[model samples]
Target: MLTVSNLYVQYGERILLDRISFMVGDRERIGLVGRNGAGKSTLLKIIAGAQSPDEGIITRPGSSTLGFLHQEMNLPKGKTVLEETLTAFEETNKLEERLEVVHREVATRTDFESDGYMNLLTEMSDLEHRFHLLGGGNKQVEAEKVLKGLGFKDADFQRLTDEFSGGWQMRIELAKMLLQKPDFLLLDEPTNHLDIESIIWLEGFLETCESSVIVISHDKMFLDNVTKRTVEIELGKVYDYKASYSGYIEMREERREKMAAAYSNQQKVVVQMERTIKRFMAKATKTSMAQSMQKRLNKIDRIELDDEDTAVMNIRFPVPPRAGQVVIDVRNLTKKYGGLTVLSGVDFKMDRGDRVAFVGQNGQGKTTLARILVHQLPPTAGEMKPGHNVHIGYYAQNQAATLQPNLTLLETMELHSPPEMRTRLRSILGAFLFSGEDHDKKVSVLSGGERARLALACLLLKPINLLVLDEPTNHLDMLSK
Candidate 1:
């Protein structure tokens, strides 16, 4: 079991975690959930030893290993997907090489009774045992299986990591972590880049994998499918439920209802006690009784209600300008980079106010098509025509990363927004959960989810007849999604 005891974390004056405590049993699947910036990732980082808590200890057996796949990891550029993933068995490979050397030494040595020879034999035996424990043999086959499960193709296995987009690179990292098969796995937003098919495959993989997992994701259905337990972080406190995501939701509502009723009853009792105390105090002979009643009231433990952030986001897209019957028309549209053809002879048309969803495996030209429609990427062959007076507002998959890192949150919005929209910039950002000091925060300092929200907020600054979004809800929190 992995135990986090009285984990306390603070940032500035804000208490992100207040002596939170939880334990994850062996092979337990936990879903870590919270709103954006609620310190869900921070708690995971503390458990993984990537970041330290203000005061706490995480206890796990010495034999158990931990693997954490965070959002901001940087993959090596030169190595192919398979090569990078195989590195997960680094210790295993080393043990195998040492075993070979020892075998050759044993065969060449004639002194059978020598202590040195005996020690070599002992080392070989130990190495073989450890290597088998680490799943040393068939490393390539295991790596390939994980890669394919993460939506990587056979051709992609040989391609350099840098050749893939950020989302695909994230998959490569996830594949490496899965191949490691650690005892405790901490996955942060594992489904952010995956398509529906890959997400389903991952759900099945996690369900069968013999690892205690704490997955932080916005996809409620994904959590419902894979996790058996749910740990929620809210108001600098932790709530643990012995149920899946959906079950937790129902249980949480019941808990809140009970708490609300108890609080209400307590308030009524307190009010009656106060009135009695006031009446007693009016008569001089009953002053002592009033004093005793006041002490009783003061000693009573308050039935405190859980403080929930019920602030609903006031997100409203600008009214789009009217356009012709057809918003966009594509005929035999094709896009290619070098010799790789992402989209070939694809034909699609969107009438005014027509909503369409493009779903496919990663690297299947979803983003490519969206970009081409918005005129960000020119088609290599064929043509795409816009209807009369059609304006396009595009939200790219890499929108968060594309923001200026040095600029403050408010500045980024103002820089991209039109002069007429400047007055409404703060309001729009507030609606997206960027308020007060958050507006002054630099883009570089924001979390991936926060950056994603900011990017989506920026998109609503302008009005357009056609709006194109590629994986827009990937980084949003549950409420935002």
Candidate 2:
């Protein structure tokens, strides 16, 4: 069992966690969720011993190993897929090596009844038992199995790690972590770069893993499929719900309603008491009653509801004149760099107001196709034509670079909007929850969700009938999704 008590974490003046506590029993799967900057990742790091909290105690059983998969860990290059994964069994491999050395020494001995021969035999037997216990002989097979389950083909196993993309490198890291098979596993956004098929395979592997696993992710379907419990971190505290994602939502709603009702009843009592105190005080003959009311008021505890805000993109496309049915058309579109083909022989069409979702695994030409459709990347062997009155408003997935870092929220809108639309800049900013000082804050200081909302806000300044958003909801919360 792993347990945390009085976990208080703070960054400078901001308190990220306040007296949080939780436990994970053996073989339990828990999902950690919250809004952006709600300390989900921080909590994972603290548990993994990568960060130290100001005040807390994390207790785990003795001899229990922990495997943590962080997002920003370095991977050694110049190693094949099999070699990288086999590194996880370093101790087991060393044990097997020692066993071989003992066997060789025993075989080279002349006297079979010698004390040294007996000692070697006994030591070899113990080493053999330990090797078998550690699954040393089958280590290579286990490593291959995990790598394949994570979507690496058998032919690709011999390839060098440097040949794969960043996302594939992340998968290698994941495979190494899985091979460790620690008593507890801490995974942060494990499915970020996975395709649908790979996600399904990983979910199955995690479901059968005989260890306590805690994962932080934005994928609701993944959480519901893999986790048996949901641990939500909100407002510097933790709430434990003994159910899946869907069940947790229902229970949270019920709990909110109950709290709202209780607060309403308390407000009514406070109002009635104040009214009675006013009526009696006006008489000038009920001084004791007024004093009693004052005491009660002083003793009453004000109820404050949870101030939970959901991250959402308030996107309103600027309406343009109605266009023809066909907005975009591509014929035999093909894109290639040298001999490598990113996309080839792809035929697609987008009509006006078509909200098609491009679903595929990472690095499967989804973004490449989006770029082609927007005319940002020229196709080598095909043509794209826009129909009459067709206009395109594209939102790039990497909005951080596309947006001006030096510009404030209001300034960004002013730069993109027409002069006549400038009058409504305050209202527009308010709609995106950027009122007050937030409007004056620079885009560089904004969080990922904030940046996404600002980018969508910038899109509203133009008059375009067609909108193409690539991974618009990548860093958004549940409400945003």
Candidate 3:
């Protein structure tokens, strides 16, 4: 079992985690959920011993081993995929070598009854046991099995690590960790770059893995399929729920209802006590009762409801004059870079009010088509036409770079908004959960979520009949998405 007690973590003056505690049983699978900056990653780092908390005790059995996978890590280049995967057996390989040395010495000895001989034989037996336990007998076969399970082909196993992209390199690192077979695994956003098929394969692998797992993921379906429990971090505290993602949502709603009811009851009691004290202050006998009631009210513990932070992006584009039925029509669209073809004569159409989601592999040209539709990039050889009265509002995935970094939140909105809509800027900002000091913050200082919200706010300043959004939910939280 692994346990955390009274964990506290702070970043300068800001408290990220406060007195949080939880436990994981031997084979438990836990899913950690929270907003982007709610310390989900920080907690995983602390558990992995990569970062120390301000005050806490993490206890695990001395015999346990841990494996951690972070989003960013320096992986050794110029190594083949097979060579990298085989490195997990380095210690076992050394043990096998030592066992070979012991066997040779034993064979050369003429006297089998000698004390030293007996000792050497016993040590050799122990080494053989451990070697088999570590899969030294079939290490290469096991490594290939793990590689294939992670979507790597046998033909690609000998390819150099540097030949692969960053995302594929991350998968190599993950493959190595999975092969290690540690007692516990700490995974942070393991499904970030995975395709739908790869993600399903990984989820199945994790489900049957022997190690205990604690993963932080934004994919609700993944969590629901893999984890048996949900651990929620909110407002610098942890709430443990012994159920899957859907069940946890039900329990959270029930908790909120109970809290609301308790608060209402307490308010009624306080009001009645105040009225009694005001009406009977002059009567000596009743004055004591009123004083007792006042003291009881003062000592009562108040029920504080969990404050839900609204999404900082409330995007509602102003409606432009109605457009024709067909907003965008594309035909025989083909895109290529030198010898690599991204899209090949793909044809699609978008109506005025269609909310379409393009799903495919990372490099399959979804974003490329979005850019082409918005006129940001011209297609290699195709025609795209907008219907009558169609006005487009384009949102790029990297809006943080597109928005003016020097402008404050208030200024960015005002610059794009018309004079008549300027008066409603504060209300619009409030809808996006930006108010008072938040509006004064510069775009450069905002987080990814904040930048995305500001960019969406800019879109709402103009009238648009069609919205071409490219991964608009990339930086958004679960609720925001």
lDDT of each: 0.88, 0.82, 0.82
RMSD of each: 3.1, 5.5, 5.3
lDDT of 3 at 168: 72
**For each candidate, what TM-score against the reference?**
0.91, 0.76, 0.74
Predicted model with the maximum TM-score: 1
Candidate order by TM-score, highest to lowest? 1, 2, 3
Model 3: CA > 4 A from native: 73-76, 80-144, 154-165, 273-281, 286-302, 310-312, 316-342, 348-355, 361-470
Looking at model 3, report the run of 10 residues with the lowest lDDT sum.
Answer: 308-317
List candidate 2 stretches off by more than 4 Å: 11-14, 94-135, 269-304, 318-327, 336-343, 360-364, 375-380, 385-466
Q: So what's the TM-score on candidate 3?
A: 0.74
Task: Put down candidate 2 lDDT per residue, 1-481, tens digits, no spaces.
Answer: 9999999987555577999998899899999988765788788888989889999989998878898986555789999988988898887878878887887888789889889888888888887876775567899888888888888988888989998866688899998888777889999878866778889989998988877999988899999999989999887989899998888999889988988998999999999999888888888789788989979987999886876656454656566879899988889988896777988888888887677888876667887788887789989898888888877778876653477889988899898889878898888887776757678778875655667777788887778887777777665667766
**Model 1 lDDT tens row, 277-368:** 99999999999999999999999999999899665567797887799998888999999999999999988999987989997767778888
lDDT of 3 at 226: 91
* Cα distance off (Å), candidate 2, residue 404: 10
